[model samples]
Target: MTEKSFAADLKLYDVEHLLLAETGEPPVSARDAEARDRVWEMAVRSNPALFDGPVVACGGVEWEGPRTLRLFWARVTYRHYALRRVPGAVALPSLFVNVLQPDTDGRVLAVRMSPSTAAPGRWQLPGGSVEPPEVGAVLDEATLAGQAARELVEELGVEAADEDLRLWAVTRGENGSIGLTYRAPARAEATLHAGLESARAADRARGREPELDAIALLADAAELSGLQGAHADYLEQVVRRFTAAG
Candidate 1:
């Protein structure tokens, strides 16, 4: 398969606008539904706490220019991710916000996902699936940035304001998932380490499993190959771009 390209310029339309323009239902047929159910059952058996929540995933993307892309949104249940590994199943591409933090020394921070979550043990930036806007509401750039900021604080214990995040690139994976990548202001490595440790301890105190168990600082793309588990297709490209810019 050919590798996908990343778009540096993005135009985010309101969720309401995208829904109005969306054409077809995601290609989930009865067979796909059966496959999803079987996979979901096994997933829940492994981790019964999984909840099928409502999420807004990217249904499609269109390039309007060399660097500009427009995103379309769709409503999907969290269970739809189970179909990702099922052969020939055309599931809605999950839209997630990935925040890449580069410290003053130029190392980018990546996290190792916890075993209880989907894509456990995978090394990637801190992020989560996009949730749908409230009924009759529209999701705009500020709201999306706010979600990214919240993920940083919750997962890494780093405090970054929404305006501090700059949407740097939008990458589409081979599986069709879209990652809205953002770059935040660089901080001291010691500060990041302390914040992460505090965050992990807080999770344990709350009786909740932290989403990430380990964190690594990568100075270049070559370091990514040393990490474990599957990574998003955009990981290397994002790391390279960030490192090069520094």
Candidate 2:
């Protein structure tokens, strides 16, 4: 693979046309499978909260026309990503959805992953790995938007209609993972703060730690530099684009 294809920086694309097709999981060698299992066990030991839940993985993506992409995917568990640590393993890329929630002032919301969650301390938009749809169900743009909306409510306590969440952009970054970004309606800054507090409180009541530990409203990508911990690879690019448009 070319260096550019695996570059750490994210390549952003406008959401013009997207096609999703189901495909079989990438073949794994016996050695790689054993290594992957060992890595996942070690990870679980380190973070007991880790769950090997079902998720969608991006098999590959190809361009059919300008601003058009055809993405092949397969069902896999979170443990499948552990294969990335196995030598010579060609791991499939992760597929996830995130929402760009801006306040009325055009400041976008960014949240930090909690210690209990994977990627602890990393600041990113409110989102999670895309869960595979039930058997006989389909995965598509509308489904992705709905997942994004659900993430917004879970992380930020904001309820947005799935239809109102517009497909904004697509990003490829860390581990060649694919992300679908959605734009949500702007809300008052105070309202956002209140909602986050409520969400965190609810999680606590359920005896579970909140997925996000902190939140920030950044006006531009440069502000990301001021954050204490590492920033998600696609965050700066997404923030810059959102801020520049206003």
Candidate 3:
């Protein structure tokens, strides 16, 4: 089988229904497991904030029909991603959700990762790896929307009702990772800035660093070039789709 090229353009899908099915965790060989552990330990030494907490990974994806997709997921921890450094070891793709938070002027919000993060200084949407659902619970579109809304509140101090989030697009990017992008109700730019300041203060009060260090609102993909940092692979694609929709 040909290894998928990470350089390939991201594929976008207009998925209305995401049918999730569990395949459990991917099998890791003894050699790969040892290597993964070593890599993870080194990573932790470099960034103590890197947690091994449970997260979801995408095993595979299949199109069920028009506007519908069947996604196979697995429960894994952040450490599983370290397999990427173990040559010839196949790591499950990541599953995550992000919000395309836009201001009243139609500019989408992008945030810079703080020094404490795994991808420090990278610019991306406000989101994180999908946490595993509670025991015996199912992962679905509504659940994903709830996660997206919670991310905005946690990262930006912006409150959004779960029902208010709309699944805007699904994207497949490098390493076959899947990203679920949701559209949030537009808010005033001033309101967003105030929320960010409040959230930063709250984090500092807890003796922790804010997850996001800075933010920018862009009306189109062209504006992304002005941000001085590596960008999330799907950022440009998602931003283009957002701007073109207007």
Candidate 4:
């Protein structure tokens, strides 16, 4: 059969398209099989017969497109033994965090950032991917207190002694590809800096301090629930343990 040229941007949608790249199933699992079936059904939702063979998905596929389109191929392969989407050439590194905080008023000090960030209009702890400059003494130091302290001063405009920060927890990727190390104030703070100018131009952008939006004292898990996404989940787990210890 002659290969038909597809459109530049063919769109595909299915349950399989929603597969989380980091979810608990194998790269291709039974869940993926189900997802693929759902996506196939969705494809046939229009024509009702594309499930029999390899149905071109996503207009011949663009290697430079979004991650979702590429995942359809894996789902189809695992479930229908077919091809629904084409692969893209993009490889984005999964993110790891370096959330830091201060202790005050029986409440874990948390900072909110400008929602204009990549996560968009959400609150997260102050931290990010570790820098190459932080590689020296911190490689063995899981908490990397020294680096966290420096980040506090540089990013958050807070002065924290290395000895004044404590490790709260270490969240690692399932396969241990990376770890999100958390640290918090060992004592009350004397001053705080937003690190707006230097931090923005240096790393994130210009004057992009999320912590500048609004900060609140979280009383308990119920109160902290006001936060969204993984940050909320992480704070619940970490702060609950903190409360139990006190």
Off by over 4 Å in 1: 1-24, 85-88, 228-230
lDDT of each: 0.78, 0.89, 0.89, 0.41
- Report the lDDT tens digits of candidate 2 across residue range 140-225: 88888899999999998999999999988999988888898999999999999899999999999999999888999999899998
- Model 3 lDDT per residue over 44-139, tens place: 998888889999999887777767778889999999999999999989999999998999999999999998888899999999889889989999
lDDT, candidate 4, 167-226, per-residue tens:
445432322112244565543443432344444445445443433344455556566766
> Against the hidden reference, what TM-scores do the models get?
0.85, 0.95, 0.95, 0.47
TM-score of model 2 vs. true structure:
0.95
Error of 2 at 131 (Å): 0.7
Candidate 3, superposed: residue stretches over 4 Å from native? 1-10
Check candidate 4 and list the clashing pairs. 10-59, 63-88, 63-89, 113-210, 113-211, 114-210, 115-121, 156-193, 157-193, 200-205
Write one digit per residue (lDDT tens) for candidate 1, span 33-133: 99999999898898876889988777676655544555678777889888886898877778898898988899899888898887778888999888788
Measured with C-alpha atoms, the lDDT of residue 197 in candidate 1 is 90
3 versus 4: better lDDT goes to: 3
The 10-residue segment with the lowest total lDDT in model 2: 1-10
lDDT of 4 at 136: 35
RMSD (CA, Å), candidate 4 to true, equals 17.0
Better of 3 and 4 by TM-score: 3
lDDT of 2 at 201: 97
